[model samples]
Target chain A: MKNASSFCLLLVSLITPSLWPIIGHADGVFAFSPEQAIHVRTLAASCAACHGTQGNAMVKEGGNTSEENNPVLAGRTREDLLSKLLGFRDGTRKATIMHQHSRGLSLEEIDLLATHFSMQIRVIRPPLSPQKLEAEHG
Target chain B: MAEPFNRRAFIKAIGATGLVLASRPSLAMASKPPMGRVVIVGGGYAGATAAKYLRLWSLGAIEVVLVEANRQFVSCPMSNLVLGGSKSINDLTFGYEALQANHGVIFRHDTVTAIDAAAKHITMLGGTLSYDRLIVAPGVDFNYQEWPMLASLDAQKQVPHAWKAGWQTVNLRQQLETMADGGVFVMNVPKAPYRCPPGPYERACQVASYFKQHKAKSKVIVLDANAEIISKKGLFAKVFNETYAGIIDYRPDNAISHINLATKTVSTEFDSVKADVLNFIPPQRAGKIAQEAGLTEKDYPWCDVNFLTYESKLVPDVYVLGDSVAAGLPKSAHMATNQAKVCASAIVQLMSGSLPDVAPVFANTCYSFINDHAAMHVANVYRYDAGKKMMVSAEGGGVSISPNEKEAGYAHAWANNIWADTLS
Candidate 1:
């Protein structure tokens, strides 16, 4: 038993040096790095409902009723988009809808969404011809 | 194939490796450099708060230098009330003496001419200064050329963009004072990417409130460049419709295209509107210093940096904060102050050879006063997202008070708290 205790102590001493690697791994997991694309993709799952799969924003025939007060972010500059998201998150660009959506997001999620949307090609969706929609519905 | 590591062994391994890594040359290099100096530009909310927090966290290990072009920072946050005559400019003005005495910040009253990011040195009108880490928060500069009509000398003389603090604010207020009782005061709200998104609406509310009291015959018309006004829209509309019914007219989705200053008329994409007094808030970007440093993207002013550390991605040992950074934080004094604290803490950790485990939580409370006695507030918390390279908001974030008298009173108190927290 004494020999086992000494052996365990020796083993503990040998294992101590490896502790930094674990800490380093933890730091890697937590650190805000540029290559967290997978994590970003996972976080962006929640945004697919409104922003669409890749942030192309799925606008229904009636328009986004939930976001009627806000403009659809289909195609905008990354800087412009990021600023708006920041504003919404910080309550600087307050809207009941955006405030709720933004408040739930972490900074990482915001960055991920901003990055994902920032790279999206700007495609101007022609405004719905109101008369045509009305006639079709009628 | 390998045996499962027990908890004690795992902990011991972690502890031992931490010690070894702690003894590495790189880790040792993280120790506080010999009296490292931080030179910050701009003395507004960002710079002042940064200097204070840096001093606090460093415990007098780092030297804090603040360079400000203006003698005093006249807060742009609540200056709308000043225009409405509900408050004085004196109430908005704050000096750096308290900051210097209490925080041990070295204040240099000078304009920054250029920043040599390569050398980590900044050239100023007064002298050249070197910094271990430079924090640039020079606020914003208006792009008059964005609207050609407003850029013309004749038009500029008549229409004022009181977006920037100091003379601009005073000029706009004076123009309002000179307007006839029945004159129309036209305020233009620029599109996104402008400083203080809610500012224009807040200004309109205050102006409408003022006209109700002093210039009842005069009406304030808001021509917005965006599809919708930002923040507290329901509350603002309700208050305006109920309290200042005929005094205020709001139009969104109306982008101002031109201004015929000769005739005091402005043209938007939709229609033309005439005014006796026009306040045009043009689109904005980061300041010139940031642009010269190659820190800005195409038309956007400001450097892209790690939101948690405020460290420039392009330049090492250089931090960018406030409106000058593409931080996924609001461009408000409150957000800037929190960002300054985060940056300061990160700098401390980097210098002290210790890992900072503290998670950064940024809080912002924006208060908009509908009238002298009543106000509205919105607050939120923000955290960093490395994967997305952005900041995101918490879900189910802050709410405006539900039109209760008690809440209104609290809103007033909140405003007082904001003013004290920012300036005092």
Candidate 2:
């Protein structure tokens, strides 16, 4: 399997640049190794379905964007996020769904998630506009 | 017996390898690495989420093309509210503009006619697209073998399924609106492993809520093929028995044996029911595209996948997601998006010559509204089980004790956040 992988790598190097676009200059560089960054990003995205992408949770129209509305986790201090996650895991922090989620995660994973969200840059994005239903919908 | 990897599969796998090694030298020079294109079919929750995350996690390094038949996204999650009159299809509809604008994902509003897996190219109505990796997330297609009479589009117009949350949803809502006060609204629940286990029950509640508000004399007859409720049993049972006691007639283990469209009647082994508005949600399998691509097994309707990467067990370089995947987990929108994220992560890692997370963990949260402003949820965290080679439910995961208004607030917030997360 190892030999096959290396062979595949060699073939990829010879073929991919011809099929795909090459960067003119190095851009969108990663600080962490490619694998580590992808692992953490995938984990963080699991929370995105409810918490907005990168923990910038969106609120209802005309609703306040405070902690009351699914509280934004991005750009917070690491200590604050870690303490809250630990509290949720330990049953100290009361939550409707967080407790259920936090209890299943390992302590190490919770700490990692806290650090992941803390590093994200929070931006107050405009809420997406809902499209009208078509007269003849499929 | 391992099937030999085709030349197309080898090329894709190598493309992934190129993404890794090419970037290493580029990183040393403080530049970005070159990456290959990924073509995703069916832009529902699974495909759309995959497209967005592939671009997001790859930081615009990878080219992602999303091919969808529809112009807008109609959510199957909150779509039940459309039947109860609490929300409109418009409120649940969204365009792909955000995904294209924010994530730089290429959007193609065209239907895929055929997928040549061995060639790594798709033949669509408009044109052909080649890719290094293919993600097929076509949700579900209703099975009509048993009731061949209801297979036609015209038949669906009268006895609608409304399962996909589009034209059928509108048709069903209109049928209910025009129904007399004393009319009977009959709907059936397909057997287990259908899309959204709690969905049929929630639809019954929505129809009942609508009837209770406008037509006091109307009745809702729920004919479930399963022996009992498959999801949120305690909560759904309580709501059916107590809240809509007189309005809802809950019948279990009553599989449909025959349908008489002219008579507006459905027959089981021992019973025959006629209704003013008939909702027939037939048993389902993977979408036709997956079936055509030879993704599903000979006996099973769903495509088997490695839960870690959601890569097809049958085909190399072809990943399956959403309701199309055969799994023990509930086929909910949240589960589909989570699977998409995991698949996207694996693809990114694979392209860069690194191994995917061996112990991938994720959560699935599903909210079912009992009414316009009251809801309940079932949530769980699942981790990859090495022995089973699939995701298994972890500890501390279950359903809500009861339906309440607070969850309703969270439910709407969930819709907004997930939409933004998926599209923007």
Candidate 3:
């Protein structure tokens, strides 16, 4: 019985590696459990419209962004992200959209967002063309 | 303590690290099996968002099937642009391809016939599907009894509400385009608790902007049932007074008693106003499915739901969100999407035999354009009010100081991002 069980376990391990792509790793990017991936992605997604997708922005906030605006959030220290969000939420920092967006998030959600965004790899984005900008400009 | 949850506890419950590490699979990840089946009805902002996030949080362990009557979801948020000629029907239309392809959310292109709340199953055109948890985000439906003349399915087209988007939007655009110069384009705003509280005013602004540029002599007359503007009151009022003074005529407390379709006139209790193109938006209730399921028992025209989890107070294991639920949150795309996340989180936690976060918080930003080039917005944060049993405006949260031209771009960004967030 012990030998049969060992054989069964070996067979399962062998098959799981093969089925990884088909079942488990199908969403190849997010290997973590759905809940964690979602928790990070969804909260981070709320910032995407203005902050750029996943917190990498070519332009800054307040409809007028210059070099003076902060750098990309990806790969920043967890403490930096948390402080900025808390600043926006508590009115310590001046902002256009972030203040309104960050007002109600609990400290836990803030921590999750900070950890998620800070851990991501920073992405450098190309500038938008005038025509493309026109199309994007509502 | 309502300090909410610690990071370690949340990590332990999801077992996300353990599963990916492929260690502690026997004891840790097994604590909360990721095998709950959730079925959501409707594929609008609320439903689509719930479908996607449910899968995201469950790590695809929970099977989520979205049953939508329409193949393509039309957004009512930016659909108002169609009437003023800034956008087309195609721009407002979205397909379910991404929700299926990217998120692994299953879709059923069919309508729901009935819901068996007790059995936790729903009947569709083809067959019934049972669910461990059923989420109904059916949105809102027009109450046409106020204007009986536009009651029938055929009669409704002649004076389209264009409230639900799609063909009505096209029809309304056609009406506005074909009307003669110096024509009167009249639209009525219903009472509160309707989808998109400031939508009628925004539509009025869009039409006025178009008339100012294209049909110089034409004008838009707004007849509002409510005593005053319900949302973004100061901004909307200011825009009407300064930007669209002559082009848009807004009258409050002018409720519609009946409509004479033949003469193209609307009659109120005290007066009658004639129009060239009538866009009569009717009062709305929870979508027909919710009404049929007896979810709106208290005459509130919406299902009562707990703000934290969005579970139906009337039915066990059946949750409702968006405009269909009597949550104090405004019925806008932003609010609906936020509510959907809260609901999805709670469901996953419940499925895992863990408690949902006690003190939930989210924000809603509503952006409405005053013209093609200019826009305004109101951004407010909301917290779960355990005392009131609903979500209310958090302290120090309110509308923007004023409307601005720069906000137009931000508004467009909002539309672009929100639609992408919900659909893609």
- Global lDDT scores for all candidate models: 0.64, 0.83, 0.74
* Candidate 1 lDDT tens digits, B1-424: 2212234532342343344336544444433433577889887777776776676556556777888887666767777887878776666666666556544567777788988888778888867888888888877766766677776545655777777656566667888888889999998888776777678888998888778888889999999887776776787778768877888888988888877777888888779989988888888777777777777777556579876678888778778778777765567776776677677777866776654423455446676777665666666656565577567675466657544344444433333333333332
In candidate 3, list every pair of residues with a backbone clash. Answer: A34-B56, A34-B59, A35-B57
> After aligning candidate 1 to the native by TM-score, how far in Å is the CA of B177 from where it should be?
2.3
Better model by TM-score: candidate 1 vs candidate 3? 3
Candidate 1: TM of chain A?
0.51
Predicted complexes: DockQ each: 0.05, 0.41, 0.09
The local lDDT score (0 to 100) that residue B373 gets in candidate 2 is 84
Ranking by lDDT: 2, 3, 1
C-alpha RMSD values across all candidates: 18.9, 10.3, 13.2
Worst 10 residues of 3 chain A by lDDT: A129-138
Cα error, candidate 1, residue B334 (Å):
0.7
- As for lDDT, the candidate ahead, 1 or 3, is 3
* Steric collisions counted per model: 29, 5, 3
For candidate 2, write residues B252-331 as lDDT tens digits: 99998999999889998879999999999999999999999999989799999998899999999999999999988899
TM-score of each: 0.68, 0.88, 0.81
lDDT of 2 by residue, A1-138 (tens): 434433433343345332123223222221444444655677778898778888998865576444226778898865567677766766666788888988888655665676678777787875678988786557
Best by TM-score: 2
